[model samples]
Target chain A: MGNVREAVDSGTWSLPQWADQPPDPDLTGASFLLISYGDSEAEAVVQQWEAGLRRTDLDPPVLRFHASAFDRDQLADKLAEARCGVRLMIAGGQYDVLQAMATARALGLETGEITRYATAYEDLPLFCPHCQTTSRAYAEVFDWTDCTGCHRVLTIKPHYSSQRGSFLGVDTR
Target chain B: MTDQRRLRVTEVRSLCPEIRQITLEPLEGTALMGFQPGSHLILHAGEHRNAYSLTGDGIMPSRYTVSVLKRNDDGGSAWLHQHLAPGSEITAEGPVSMFAPVHNQQHALLVAGGIGITPVLSHASALAALQKSAEVIYAYKPHRAAHVDQLREICHSAGFRLTEVTSAGNCRKALRDRMSDQPVGSHAYVCGPMSMLESFLEIGAAAGWPEYRLHLERFEAPELDPGEEFALRVSGSPEDLRVPVGVSILETLESAGYSVPNMCRQGVCGQCQISVRSAGSLEHRDYVLTEEEKAAGGSLMVCVSRGTDVEVAL
Candidate 1:
């Protein structure tokens, strides 16, 4: 997919975080809290997050929603007033978290500023650089796949795009 | 030989008992290369080279200005304060930048501690010139508030908010209160002592502020224990090189005829980063690399970092 192949091959692959680090101690004082979760498996992680919040002296306004209930328009309205001190915590499958992450980035929130915990593995959301179409595929399925828009076989490299908040799909055919 | 430029010191004004503001002009009378708001200059004087933040307007800089906080042990600052005077010429290099303001942000917040106001001052001025909404919070020791009058003038003219916090009172609470009010899409630039920077970083991360949005500039290297002797194997080398207890990896490689790119050898710059193929226990000493990059074991700054025994992609 254009120059994306060369860029991905030359770039470094960020290792996944297999273990969770302790939550930021100042998270309780966050003025706004946005959380997204998927499935019952994430409930335990969400409950632990809530318990941590309870120990703090400050009580912030929190909006918790399910991944399926993630309404883009509604989240956009809620984040319209998002500011620097806002804290976000996301928990769910990889696909669900990636979708939520895209939304957060669109709202100008940085990845380092937010907390993420994946409860389940899912297909990675990828954007084809050739046709500019988005698709999802499991990492273990194949090294290449057909682009949804261009209908061309595209190679899936390990490179991630911070701007698109997704992996890149380069043309292999 | 280093790419050095000669600058003439035109003015030396004492901002306070311990701080000196020195103004320099390019001797060639030509416009210097333009720089960003948070750029710094490396001054070389009498075997000492130190990085000082440029306090002047970066857009159309006619001259360079830097404020030095004299230290008893820091020979560089002491030397400048004692020997540098009007009409004195000194050699300097670079307007290199390791910290810069986020351009796309709607609002900007700058926090400064002690003498860290140098770069923050430039940020405020740049933001004001861009007509962006910005605020500055400067915390200083009561006795060391040397440029209060100049700072007040800048804030009043730029139409941005300015807050001065003195150490004698509850300044920490005041800083936190201000930080809590930052609007979304706002970026904060911080510089100063390590303790203050750490406090802001910890609190900001906890508040869900993204790491990319919080920029930092540190004047000193992190306190690290001396490293033990180690064996290093560089790519394209035939023999295993021995690094002594006191010698740095950068020095060892340079002395071995390898031209390793570097700036701010104090571990603030990321130029000397090299890939690690295999290694023993690594002692990471640089501020540039992220935690993930460090744990990935693929990259390390050779200038300050050391390991027990390692193989590197030169």
Candidate 2:
């Protein structure tokens, strides 16, 4: 859509103020973990992540796999590494990565992803076969993958788009 | 300079199971004249507004109409679709002008994918009402059954050209053939998924329309990463200011007094794109730039795009 402000005035308009200097993301101690469901999902996720990462030199780490392959042990290892810095991981196809995250939390790992809804998961409890704990955090942060459970820090990257807010790995669930 | 009017919801009507038409009316005694053909409004539902094209002529007594469809995947769509209903009022600003097809052209062809048909549908309606010549190529996935019967009826009454390509055929080849057959001065408008938009851009550019004539509307959400803050040096300024992570470049620019023209700060319109003098990748979310222009790396939409610590002549 076009800017309605410009459509009306049709004259020389001013942009918001800015310095000519560019912004940096690495200095922000950033690393994003991109998790895709399968090899096919890798291209789009990678392209999107890379496009967003252009403003920064720090390339976010990516882990691409099918959700069916998500085991509790593998997820725990990824979450343990996120504590050193600000990390972003994108998982495609809602439940695979998210279910794995839920399982990792049940195993007492830092892995967590929540849904934004205020209600509880109405269905039967889906548990990690390893930990045998019913994963409840997925109820709040809907369809996202991150390791926020039992972690030292849950620092959310500043100024990130709210479109990804549903994907936040908060323990609020 | 009187106080300009803010947009308000005048009416909301559900056309189908997931399709709803929201009519916005400007308050009385407000200077909200109306919107141009092919423009869209950003309905501020909450923190972010999903940009929907103006499906109705803005000439009515200040009521702007936008047809919204509920997509299961998009959070913004899911929120607006699930929560919004008739008589539920919210803040409405804009009739933002991005991806407006240039007027007075011989043939204005519009291609839409699924719900991408909204903007083109509006444009075709306006063109036919004005007795102008235009064609619409609407592509829908198989069995989605998005309410196009009303749109077809509207197009029929208006006497505009309409073509629907269902799942059985290839849309890109059809588009390429139609585009090639058109004469000079024909402009194309595309709005859909990013991949579809990219494909159109690549094909349409190779088909040879001028940079200004090919309009596009992108539907992807702007991705933001606020890992680190940086210093911003405005042109013709002595002192530099520190911009913290998560603060938008437009907000930073406004705070420093160099105002750039922008509406729909969600990066849908190309208004905030600055001409960069250095090499950098642009996080393109606006409908303003062509794919060729985007690949050049000189222009970046400042509202959502971040730079790699290199200075550009804004």
Candidate 3:
């Protein structure tokens, strides 16, 4: 079910490459399409982007947000209308960002077409192999957490499956 | 370059006056690798090598099929046309998937011009097998249109729509309107003359399509103007080569008693990538590198691209 890789700078290969804040995207590349989650720092992230582009004749990026997470229906509607020179950026909880990425990918968005920013990794969605249960845990790669379903201690894997939208929690012992 | 295989021509058919469709299978008993839709094979005949788009399904293909446009040059097509009899053997390199369809792609806007329909045929087969509805716009002169009957049959069988245009103007006029009807996550692939490809790219870009969703294959282009002469300094070496206007960097490197691993000297093969340690300006004019790869400025294809006051790692 897995393969492997090496390690180097920028911390490690497994971690999603993003700063604590979403960096300013190259505005001239493509018109931005921002997807933010609920009333929080994410809303502020959206507002920060909106205010920065008042000068140019660039089309104001369309913002699609959900109260809790991303609304697939609305997201699909907006994306359907999107043309060639478009860039998509999604920001939310780590789990929700992964989910949104998977959904967008399913609709045909390639890595070059989309960008992601995780606002919170504290509530990382951990999927336990033994109990087959998914639970949120304050864990990092190689960290240990217990499954709520079968009560088995699991080690969070470095490998993140975008399709499953969760980090694998392997019970080594 | 190491994995070379010989394939025997199983069948050959004259698609039209200028084009011929040839089917090839393993010369000996061996399983050929399955290919993706829009894959191409670099066929070698004598001193010339050319890449031809496979006009069949990618799944564990028993025989590879390609439709070639006879340009009258010795680069495989003219040779293949000259030797069209069955049982003829030829060496081939790969079923390269550079211009393939994207995975999990919702809809495809396949635009082809003249001989560019070869890959689009493969894509149509793929979309049909998946039972996905797609659109195919083939632009060609009435006499030059290959695979029109086959395309019509595929359209009849599958849910695909086939629209034929006599000129590039008609296709360009129709492309914008057709793109709007696609669902989210759709990709538009254009394999044609440079003008058609440019128009599709322009339309897609103007309409807000991302670079990832817009795919194109350019086998031919108007002759590139000889760039300005520049002196290249090899990193950590005393060698300084003065590259003139008419010659490429690879030829210059060879002339200076240096050997670089390369093929398809015209820059299509991408076998001649070198580390661009530093440069004053890099003019990347190859089909291989992605936008990010070119922007990263680490390596560049030595064949077509040129740099000024550049220090390259030999």
Q: Which candidate should be chosen as best, given DockQ against the real structure?
A: 1
Fraction of native Cα contacts reproduced by each candidate: 0.56, 0.00, 0.50
Estimated TM-score for each candidate: 0.70, 0.51, 0.76
Instruction: Output the worst ten-in-a-row residue range by lDDT, candidate 2 chain A.
Output: A111-120
- Residue range B99-176, candidate 1, lDDT tens digits: 887767868888888899999888887877777778788898888886667767778855488888877244566567
Model 2 ranges off by over 4 Å = A1-173, B1-10, B28-32, B60-62, B72-76, B142-147, B157-159, B221-231, B234-267, B271-300, B304-314
What tens-digit string does per-residue lDDT give for candidate 2 at B83-201? Answer: 66655666665667665657455567788888787787777777776777677778887555354775687567543667788742467776766765553345678876666677777
Model 1 TM-score, all chains together: 0.70
Residue B183 of model 3: what lDDT? 60
CA lDDT for candidate 3: 0.78
Show the lowest summed lDDT stretch of 10 residues, model 2 chain B.
B1-10
- Give lDDT tens digits, candidate 3, residues A50-77: 5665455775555545447656687777
Off by over 4 Å in 3: A1-102, A105-107, A110-126, A136-173, B2-6, B28-33, B44-47, B73-76, B104-106, B130-133, B156-159, B232-240, B256-264, B274-282, B295-298, B308-314
Highest-scoring model, lDDT: 3
